[model samples]
Target chain A: MKNYVLNNLPERTEKPRPFGVTMAMDKGLSVREVEDLMSIASGYIDVMKLGWATSYVTPNLEAKLAAYREAGVPTYFGGTLFEAFIIRNQFDDYRRVLDKYKMTYAEVSDGSIELDHDKKCEYIRLLSEQVTVLSEVGSKDAEKIIPPYKWIKLMNDELQAGAWKVIGEAREGGNVGLFRSSGEVREGLVEEILTQVPFEKIIWEAPQKSQQVFFIKLLGANVNLGNIAPHEVIPLETIRLGLRGDTFNHFLNQSK
Target chain B: MKNYVLNNLPERTEKPRPFGVTMAMDKGLSVREVEDLMSIASGYIDVMKLGWATSYVTPNLEAKLAAYREAGVPTYFGGTLFEAFIIRNQFDDYRRVLDKYKMTYAEVSDGSIELDHDKKCEYIRLLSEQVTVLSEVGSKDAEKIIPPYKWIKLMNDELQAGAWKVIGEAREGGNVGLFRSSGEVREGLVEEILTQVPFEKIIWEAPQKSQQVFFIKLLGANVNLGNIAPHEVIPLETIRLGLRGDTFNHFLNQSK
Candidate 1:
């Protein structure tokens, strides 16, 4: 946390940052593991998402939540849990658990289920009244590639419905939505969506190194990226600061 | 650690296991982070590799070594470091450091350096006197694909030279050695290698889940897997035990 990071590295935005945010994906880490990650890379992590359906089965979930809370890191359950609750008609129960954990953020996504777009926005509106909403737009299934115009429209509608950030769903594999099966970014679709959507209001879930490099190169170092693996948090920070080889020259300009 | 795991899960080979050895690749985790990880998952880890050149730059490397030693996990420096030292004529210095660290295991490798097969075997023969050697036999570069016959011969020679285990090099990306660039297993090569080399004497570095599943299915549950990311140790154990969906049927023999 001190001078361990190099001096020539790009200056990163501090906590409560609007742009340079890195959200870690917690895939059922034990409390001790959470303690471990926070001790090392907590400075780089802005938010933590308990990856899809993991929180339900993980042991010591409350203890894990307590550890994150003590570290002042905002913890939210993943959107797959939202879909799980939606299909089971347990929306109120889901809301009650979020309240029980005193969580500050909630992700509303229909990646695995079909919810009418307006109905999803309604849930987002209601949830936004309490916790901050991070509404994800796009499907997890590689078969369902939503049109570029549809992506733009849903993003706009979600933002208007008081969603804090509209997540472009690439899943943990980085092989759906904005990316192809090969994990390559769709140039036309991404370029189109970025033109219509405010970059600040959208978080790209890029879990792969190449995808992270692509986004950082395309949008500069401060671009918000999510679903980052816990151990990769430090590596991702280095990439953001132009300290890693991938972005070593991107932020070196002193004229700025 | 109790019955948190399901009843139908495959019986895991317990501590001091021979076949189901899971070697964790520690790329310079902090002392505190190492302590936290060992506390939670040390029971699952058999050996740990301080990944390529990390021990050189990492702070508290001694403390990190102490933790793995206390946890019953033998720690070894990576192949690249051995290559680095070998190129600089520092094999004695490297051995002295191993003695200083009280490391019972050393990795003799030519992955990053072009050591003659005879010289490599001699390093294995000499180092085997002091510590148990797990010699790796493959090039790290994607361009240089070692033929299947050569793989079997080298692996046999390394084992004959006194490598406790011969590691099939897949690099941490799961894309080299006995695997294709797409991370898919080179099935015929692995089968051919298995015919000539003893299965128990080989540790395959399977860094991806699909590759892990492939080896698990091909070689059965107790396959020795290495270069596993730290967090994935538990998930890999689950895969071995048929706790996950991927290998649920393979390890489960019950009619019900």
Candidate 2:
């Protein structure tokens, strides 16, 4: 489609570009739905995460993964699924499941289960040897607030343990981890982590539009964002390029 | 596909049944996306509404409509589109657009505009002759709270004026009509309206899960619900059938 209103918009990084990655959440979309989503949004989506333990209940798992693979969008099981395996003493089985599905990426998270920090890093190291690992830092429990320094330390340790990117958990609702119950981002916590961690190596799970806008404004158009809804991919892209009303003025002054 | 757990579930009215209606809101879905949605959710969806004026901006409108038609789901332009025509003195053009798209249903709403009550009923009467009109009876503005008595009167007037079903406007967010800013149902308003207006004749636009649970609890499994997101169709069905956790206990004691 031809550009509708092309003037003073921000430039977006192309696919395979390290920054400006969008990772969409699949909370049980059918195979056809995945195909449709990929047909329209594959360009904007960098990776797809089967949200939580939905892949366990979702029918046609292999077909859904194939659809994403056909679109060249890497797919991975959500971090909670990994935790589910760990809690059940099925870490080796989880690795086999990843191989069976031919998944290129894996998410290691401790949101639902309590695990030693060192143990979490060891799991990350093992998974990284098989496929690219994205370790998630932060708890899904809204009551368990991790200090800013702890977040930075966990992220750095995970990266050192072979995680390609450390994800800041916000859950699918964007109400836990990096955000408050009211969906407000912990600004101080975020800024403190940013002081030690490079923004490009972190995928912030920003499911809400307001959260996405906050990251874009803070980290520019190339900030990596995860947990985007399938339908919101285009809208998120528009927001990143300042074509949407929310950040239209933010990128208006910059030369194209 | 066999249901995972089938016992102790509430009996849902089958497709073509009037009482337990589900109206899904399509903000902007591509043709393929609509096809994918219909494939999995056609049985659950009673009708589909193109939310607000999205039809004006959405690409491939006819193709998208065809996909819904193929699935045997009735499609309609939103009430905001109807009001857009009325304010521009293009009511005739609006009718032509309905015919052009071969729509079987149309929504008549004054949520976005300030149409006089009598004039709104007149439009309802006129459109009812051409298509099955689903007239909405609420304002979009959160500050403009219509009293319970007024809500009852407007609903009755529109139903008498030939509306197939009167819709309680909650917009797409479920936070304006029939609900508070917190997405809480206006219990007093709803109870008072039910005392006069038949619950079967009104489609409650409840986009939130809590609101859906409230209506299902208040009016049983057959209450008409509208403004449900496309992906939520199956989840809503599960809720109505007490297959989901929210309504699981509510229908557990009911006879099969």
Candidate 3:
């Protein structure tokens, strides 16, 4: 409504754009909730991921998908679900489940399991043939640290294996994977990875405000951010636009 | 639907009952979002609080309140709004705002501003005549630590001043007022406050999962909890019922 006016706010990328993608993590939000979320923040949101194995326990899964679909937001089952299926030797069933749900995107991740690197890439290739694949690189275990070189190698290999985009894992809490237990970003690792990988193709999993601010300040307004909570979508948009206090001065002096 | 069954779950007090109240914080939720949240978790939510001057800026304020009202959930502006009004010598205008919004509950707090304790009590008494008063008893500043005796005195005074209930301030992030910067509860302060004030008459603002688990375990299933996020309402209900892993073993050995 533009009830109150401000000047020179940072510009954000519109929908169907390659970069500036916002992927929200849905931890069992109801059908109505998804519809409500889409109604308000769909313009800011690029994709929705049903977090972890929540899609397995979440009721009315099809209805939730329909809500997002109607809003023109693509939905995907979380990588944990993929891991759950793979761990149970139900990879074929997982593929069929994707077709059953009419999913346009699929996430291939080894966050929860120890899988052979080639097998992970193979899964990405197979999934990419059927649906757009977003392969995540990083461990969910807080103690397990993957070196910058390894992170770059995996991201490159996954992208080479038909991954439309690679995800930098930070989990939903913004702790572990790209961040320390205290939620501090491993700046060296991130910088090193960016050196070898394209910035636009890596969606950083930043669920915390500080993490979101860090990425926005480091990568400008159009950084691809993932794993946002449903409610924080608008707040994150403001942060991206430098309307929030955290990034208020960030985009102020910069020429657009 | 009881899709999965478990034995020895905790029994929770139903709505229209005192205690066990779950007051969710609506930090500028759209009307559709409110309706969506209520549709799924109305049974778990006892009230909704418009957080910290956000009601002043939130669009569709009346319609959002209507959504909660239609779902049989009462809504109140946050104490910060009350402080904002009082600090500006607009207490009458604040009262008028309550009437204008058809608010059934009002919060009296001085978490942000410095107010004499007697004056704070007077506001509580005055607001009590108009709506149910939920007086908050802590500072928003992390460095400002109110002694246990002061918390006890403030809570007791507010209750005597006709407050329907008292709320412990833990800001939205659960990092101040009754909690340390690390998000750990002030165990001694909370323990002392419980000695003088009945647990049923106090709502602890616990936005973090671990804090929610702490209160649920200490106060049992029917503990009054406030400042919960919209999406966490269902998850909080599960915690109260021992359905979540955090409190899964807490209520296991307890007798209903």
Candidate 2 chain A vs. true chain A: TM-score?
0.97
Instruction: Calculate model 3's interface RMSD in Å.
Output: 5.9
Pairs that collide in candidate 1 are none
Q: Please compute DockQ, using alpha carbons, for every candidate against the native two-chain complex.
A: 0.08, 0.08, 0.08
Error of 2 at B169 (Å): 1.1
lDDT of 2 by residue, B1-256 (tens): 4212223445677879778999999999988888778766787789999988899999888889989998999999888899899899999999999999998899888887888899988988998889999999889999998989899999999999999999998988889989999999999899999999988899999999889999998898999999999877766775676544345446655553
CA RMSD, predictions in order = 7.4, 7.6, 7.7
TM-score of chain B of 3: 0.96
- All candidates' lDDT scores? 0.84, 0.85, 0.86
What interface-residue Cα RMSD does candidate 1 give after superposition?
Answer: 6.2
What is residue B38's positional error in candidate 1, in angstroms?
2.2
Q: Provide the TM-score of the second chain in candidate 1.
A: 0.95
DockQ of 2: 0.08
After superposing all C-alphas onto the true structure, candidate 2 shows an RMSD in angstroms of: 7.6
